[model samples]
Every structure is written in C-alpha cells, then in structure tokens.
Target: MKELNIAVVGATGAVGQEILKVIEERKVPFKSLRMLASSRSAGKEITFMEKTYTVEETTLDAFKGVDVALFAGGPASRAFGRDVQAAGTVVIDNSSTFRLEEDVPLIIPEVNGEAAKNHKGLIASPNCSTTLLVGAINPLHQKAGVKRIIVSTYQAVSGAGAAGLTELEDQSRQILDHKPIHLDVFQHQIAFNLIPHIDVWQEEDYSKEETKVLHETHKILDAPDMAITVTAVRVPVMRSHAESVYVEFENPLSPDEAREILAAAPRVVLQDKPHDNIYPMPITATGSDDIYVGRIRKDLYNDHALNLWACFDQIRKGAATNTVQILELLLEKDWI
Candidate 1:
C-alpha cells in the first residue's frame, strides 16, 4: 500500500482515540498522521502506535494536503466534512450527520465496499448500533431477501461517549455508597436501570437512535423498502452493544443454514450452541473487532423468521475500525 497523509478529526475523544489505536493495530501505512480536536483539547499530547502526536484545534485549513481524513466527532464532521473534501482530501466520517445524505455513502466495507468508490468526497459510517446490525445480517439479507426486521438494542454507555461511561461509573459508585444518584450525562439513572429513550424523540414516538437504525439498515442493505423497526435501550454496560434481532425473510431459511452462512461471513464470529451455554455477550465482545452472533434459531411460530443475538465493540467495528477500513479501501482504489 502506498503511504498517504492521514488526518484524524476529533482525535482526543473516545472514538477518536480508538481510531488511532485501530490504525496502529491494523498496521495501516501512513506517511504522516495529524490529530485535530476542539480548541479545548488542543495541545494535548496523545501517544499512538508508539508515536506521540499533538492534538491541533480543528480548522478548515487543517485538512490541506491531507489524503484521508477520518472524522470521529459529529459536530467536527459536519463542520469540516466539506472543507476537507474541498481541499482534495476524502473524509470517512463516523458521524450521523451525513449518513442519510443523498450523495454520501454510508459504508460498511464488508457489506458495501463498492459504495466507497462512488463517494463524491465524503463517506459516512453508520451509527454504532446500525453498523453492527447491518453487518451481522447483510450477507443473509442478500441470500434470503430480508423482508422485515424487529430489533431491540442494548447499547453501552460508551456509545454516548466517554462522559457516558464516566456517568455510569459515578452513578453506580454513588448508588453503592448510599449517596444521591445523579442524572446528567443520561436523562435518567443509567446505573442498574434501562433507558428506552436514546437520542431525541421523533415524529411518532420512536427515538432518534431507533429511527437511525430503521433508515440506515434499509440504505446499507440496498433494500430501501425493507420494513425495519427498532427499540433502542441504553444498558449500563461499558463498551459493547448487544442486539436481539428477529428477521423475516422472503425465503424460509433454516437455523442450521443460517448458522452456516453467518459463520463464514466477514468479520462475524458465530457461537451458537445453546445446549453448551455458548453465546455472545457484551463482556466478551468489548475491545474485540468482530461482531459476535449466536442463538440462531427459527421463530417458534414463523418458519420464515429467524431470531438471533449479536454483540460488537461500539468503538471498533461500530465506529473507528470501520472508518479506518474505509480509508484503506479508498487508498487501495486510489480514490484518496
């Protein structure tokens, strides 16, 4: 691979820091790496891949001469996406701001690698939950034609950013210490409690996070008309997000067949042995790059529908690693 100048926008945040680690763990060849964050985080020193880099305040000119810009902040992506692209640098944004845009490709390299080539300048990474959702089943959808999907997501506090994780820790500690429980990072008590609401409430009552799941799945699967509904719940877990999905396909697929298909799918680890007590869990999924799927079985009543559980590291494939993968694709295609 040709060495290219890589820039990381929002390089100090949780996801941004994860991106830096991923780039190094994956051994991506880069001529130079630039870190950009908010002015508040500027001048902070971050060491990644055994090399220290200073975080610079993000500016329009920061992207000049950059080849691949990996955006880990929502506001920064919205603020600098066009600027970087204008500077002849391509951006792979891990933000929801452009996922639904008519032009930007919401890519999961394993599922939609070709879509990266069509990116005008910016490519969007789907929401963490959506990334894991689409990734777990895109292959199945292609073979069996997914008609309807109903999913309930157990998202981690980390999905809300580092502060969310800190809030979970603080609230849990407070509750244990018999101190007053505070609710700021989360709307309600997130320690030992579940918040069904994620993001703002939308038109009919579905949360924004759920709406993103509905829309993004349809788009990434190339089934814009596919009917998908999601109930997003914030679990007190630290990092990995888990989902229980029920999918109805046009063609009936057996549990054994589904398991076989998913086991061979890219970036998926199948551990479906209920009798042996083998299954995927957030605890095991944390810090791992692969999405784990298990409990593949045919619905008791509907032979056409399949029920499964999945878990993924929200910081890895869910956000950062996918962005880095897209950058690799761009470099390989000479699109950067």
Candidate 2:
C-alpha cells in the first residue's frame, strides 16, 4: 500500500474525469498525480483530492518518473504506450487499439486478475458492454459452465464519449422546438429512435462494437471456443448501458441459484424480481461502481438458456472503475 506516482492521460475526457473521481473516492495511495491531455486541453485545471491540477499536453516525456499511467485516451496510446512502459510505468489503457493484441492482456480484476500479474507494463480494459457482461458471466461460467451467449445491447449515448451525450441532448431540444435535427455523432438520429449500429460495419455485417463484445468475452473468459453472438444498438439514454443477455449453460441452473452465485461475485449486484417491477435499469445504474443484473429467467425455447438484464454506468464501472481496479491490483501485486 505504498504511495505511487500516478498520471492520467486524456484527463479532460469523460472516462478520465471518472478515473480522477474514483481515485479520490477509493482513497488510493498516491504520492503524486499528473494530468495529461491533448494540446487542445492543455492548461485546463481539474480538481482532485481537494486540489486543482492543470492538465499538460501529453508527450513521450509525460511518463518520466510516473509509476502508473491511466490511459482513457484513444488510439493515441499507439503513440505513447511503448515509451511509458520503457520508462517503468504501467499503463492501464482504455482503448480498443490494444485489447486484441496477443501480447497485451485485457483485464477485469475480478475476472482475469491473475492474467494482470504477468503484464509487461500494459493492460487493456474491455469495451464497456463487454466488461459488464463478462463481469456478470464469469462467476456463473465458473459454477455452471456457459455454453453459448447471445446479447443485444441498449447502450447509452455516453458510450461514444461526451459528444454523443451532447448530441442526444441537443437533438432532443431541437425535436421539441421543431427545429432541424443534427445527426452527426451517430449514423442516424438518436433522440427518439434506436440505431441498430454502434460502430462501423465490417465485411461480416457486424458493427465494430458487436465484434468487440464477441472477441473480448472470449478472451476474458478464456473460452475461445465459446459460442457468442452480439448485436450492439445505440439508445438515447445519457449514462448507463443495458444489455439483454441470453446465456445457455452446459448444466441447467435455476434462476434462484444463478442469483445466489451472482450476488457473491465481485462488482455485480443482483436485482431480480419481475412481478414487483424490480430490475436493473440504466437510470438507476448510472454513477454506480457495480454492474446490476436482474430480470433473470429461463428462456422458453432452450432448456439451458437463461435470460438476464444487465446495467452499469458506462463511464464508471465500464471504463474508469475497471481501469482503477486494475491499478489497485497492480499495486497489490507490486506490478506498478
């Protein structure tokens, strides 16, 4: 529990801001903190631990003397990851650029914490939807064995970053005012409608976001042969993302038993009760650290298939919290 020097790349973004807040909420022992962002965001001040720190433009030299670098930035990691690692800093990257790399481990401390122990100075956090889904699925897989997974996400606008959220708000205002709607952040208007696509469509007709869920789940669960299919849809919600997950297990499990198992799992909250209108919802899940799972029931057609609803704050547990948790684990193991 020794104090370590910490640096936050993309300190001005939604996820970066959450990382700073979580660091303070968790009272992480840090000897020093440096805020690093793009040149456009340089000179902006961010308050953490009761003091304001000005963000500096990120550069190769940013990692010097830094012990842990939390990267909520995007592909810019391709520009700075190696240099930071070479300088003896552990980079917890929140980007898709490295998650699939064979050498870079995609970690969710509660799931593949042991994999993080072997980090060669870089760890990747999975996609928001993928992270929460696996966080809920791993415990069950260990107990009953997950045979196949089919998921459709009702993702929040914030998953695309702050711009996406703003677009939703602005578009909502426009629609209410009978003004022309601006549909820039998404391929279609997202205010009163759902977009079936989350990211760019690939040759296989799956969006990039859908593909990430498929691959990331396999990697984190260490189940490369697990049957998984995903369809990501962008919803109008501003914060938390929800998923309708249908999982087929090798062994049949009662809903009560699955709830019991998930209740004990780390970072998962079970809120199942259909008749009473009790279930996980995005509005209720926002700003929380745990992923919420509810509406658990058995699928009618498949004997082993179970239906579930999962929700979590996309910017927190989905991104920043998981990254900070990895940092905590790294510190616990003396990896940073």
The TM-score that candidate 1 achieves is: 0.98
Clashing pairs in 2: none
Model 2, 55-164: lDDT tens digits are 99999887788988999967668889877887788889998888989888999998999998778888999999899789888888998899999999999999888899
Q: Per-residue alpha-carbon lDDT of model 1 for 122-168, expressed as tens digits? A: 89989999988898888788889999999999999998899999999
Q: lDDT of each prediction vs. the true structure?
A: 0.90, 0.90
Backbone clashes in model 1, listed as residue pairs: none
